[model samples]
Target: MTSLTIPSPGGRLASTVVAMAVRQRAVIGDEVTYVVLDRQWQVVEPVEAYLEYLRQEQYSLNTVRLYAQGLASWWSMLEDGGLDWSRVKVDDLARFKRRLRDRGIDSTVITLRPEQTAASSTVDVGLSSVLGFYRYHAIVTGVPAARQFYEHVMGGTMEARSRYASFLGHLGGGQDRRVIGRRREPKGPPPFLTPQQMKVIKDDAGRLERGTGWCGDLRLRLFWTLLEETGLRLAEALLLRHRDWQPGTGTTAFVEVQPLEDGRRRLRAKNQQHRRVYISDELDDLYGEYLFLLVELGVDVQDDLPVFVNLYRGEFGRPLRPETIYDWIEGFKRRHPLLPSRWTPHWFRHTHATALLLAGVPEHVVQRRLGHRDIHTLMTTYAHVTEDAAMRAAADWKALVARWGATA
Candidate 1:
């Protein structure tokens, strides 16, 4: 038998074993034995083979982890019911699905601590993961796959997608969808900083430059400036490299994002599209300053190297993670009570969009600059800013009307 042990939360070892008999059956068209925690189960070999296929497909680490976790949970539940995976029928899967749905409903009703709420939504995602496992297993084994199971369990219906979206909306202080098909509650405008508050934030970031012996201060300043100027998402900014910047004349600097982690450097943007952003003279100067600071620190200015690194970490040179930037911004907010309470990285994007709109920039230009795949996303998110612009147009219309009446 080949056995592997994984450490559990309470310092206990969970054992997983594959027997020689199972290996022989796996090679043929028969059942295999898998033992976990001293319990034995006869499952079809395809389940194991399907998992290997998923790994080869290059799914995200979290996705792979969740699917494996789901399978383990399903197996444990089946064992509790005195059933093995090979003997489990469609009726059993249906009953398991019901239990999952009930558990999810209960979780939704329970109030979780602020920190725990994010983890709770995994219940729904876990359900989908388990269903996907079964469907893949059946496909690989040539078993009679459950069509209804795939439809309801794996494919989230429109209603289910809307409900999931609402659940997410609640985390952001929006309304939860009611079960009785009532109209969704109206939501207020998203929180954003005013122009004056934004100015204060910029000033606070500028103060970092005055400190002595801060090796990465210049990079930090550039980070903040790029966030404000380009309005890129924090994740997008973190993935940037020196090669992304183009120094030459008429050509614009571009940012390419990828949905898959492996493709981040090679593929196009998140929407599978590419965008070109004009680098202002100020941004060019900041980039130069960053390069100079890198030279001062005795670091090579390689095109493949990350644009920013943790200055505090000694010469090993670890690239800064996206969450670290958020933590720094939160720390800055705590230090400066005068700054707006609602300030966030997204607020900088909001402020940029608003400032451009107020300055009479066209909607299409703003859309391109923000790298929005859909113009509707730009319109919906910044609708209030557009409304304010609409009011200004109305005021101009009133003036024209009064002037024409007077001339008549």
Candidate 2:
């Protein structure tokens, strides 16, 4: 048997806690809990260690929750197969994949999670989490079989490599070496709005009013206007303060997306990176009018005031929630029977990416504007845009070559 070693006090402590906790669980008869986790997101063996590792790695709570659920699904499969997780062979992992595909979905059996009818994407996430669990244990808990198992599962041996530009480098932490990541090809381009659908949605937004009332709410208009123009993640827009607007940056205006670190519903961009978003001058003027409207409604027009706020009954000054914005969009969809059932507020983001690509904006520029960590992400998400862009590029090259060939 080969031995594994890690030279870190924190790593050893985490392993010890996880190992002891599971053994104690047998004596305690389930009284020994592994943190207060949602049923579907519960971890099995090494729960504390894995969770602690994620905490140390600075994964967000929401990110931790999804990762936990994926691990929980893997554990459930292991229990059904009656196999020890630590001793998992490649064949066992292959069998798990086959089982998931064969079962498809057992609605009655899968109650805790949404895997009842989960797509291929969900299955892939589960597989990734299981692999990650093995790799982590192999490194931190000194389990040699785990290293062998990780290689077998990967179907290839991994090479150690240097990784510069670490996120926690400033704190003198974060891994300087990382396993080469393996992400399966995306299942498909996400459902997005077409130019026609966007035009329709925009027209509808322009005409929105308070339910059953003749009065037009400027807040309602500004909310949709900001979302459409800036392509903000709903939470980013929801938590926007008046001070975020940095007007007059040489014929354009920019808004700063600040983090909502200390709130019940914490708000951050998907990347958790601060970004500057430019909006049309029209939107800038509209915001000015919206601020005046807020003042008229006896709401404070201060820098700290939320751009979108609850203005009904007792909840008047509270910042609006993403869900509330979604609800309003849903209501709009219902009222306009012509609206596509597949349309969601997020389609605006997709549409924005598509429109930018179609209009010949450089992908990197669009990527930066949208706060995408990778330009490849935008290219993948808007494959249709890229395809068209590719064709146009080919045509331009062909014309240039034809002129040169004729002269030669």
Q: Judging by lDDT against the true structure, name the best candidate.
A: 2
Task: Tell me the lDDT of candidate 1.
Answer: 0.54
Residue lDDT tens for model 2, 125-157: 556656767767766786888868876655554
Error of 2 at 310 (Å): 2.2
Model 1, span 1-408: residue lDDT tens: 346567989999887664311221122233222222223445434445655666465444344555555565565566557775655655665665544545423323544542222233444454555555655544445444443344343332223332222211232232322121212246555555554565466556553335553333567777877766666766566667787776536544434433323222221134434565654556666677778878887777787777777765534455676556767789787988777766677777776666666555678888887789778988888788767655454223333223212111
Local lDDT at 243 for model 2: 93
Score each candidate by Cα lDDT.
0.54, 0.59
The TM-score values for the models, in the order shown, are 0.59, 0.68
Q: Which runs of model 2 end up more than 4 angstroms from their true locations?
A: 1-45, 79-83, 98-117, 158-216, 248-251, 259-263, 298-305, 386-408
Model 1: per-residue Cα lDDT at residue 356: 63
Off by over 4 Å in 1: 1-124, 131-145, 152-191, 206-216, 248-269, 337-344, 350-360, 380-385, 388-408
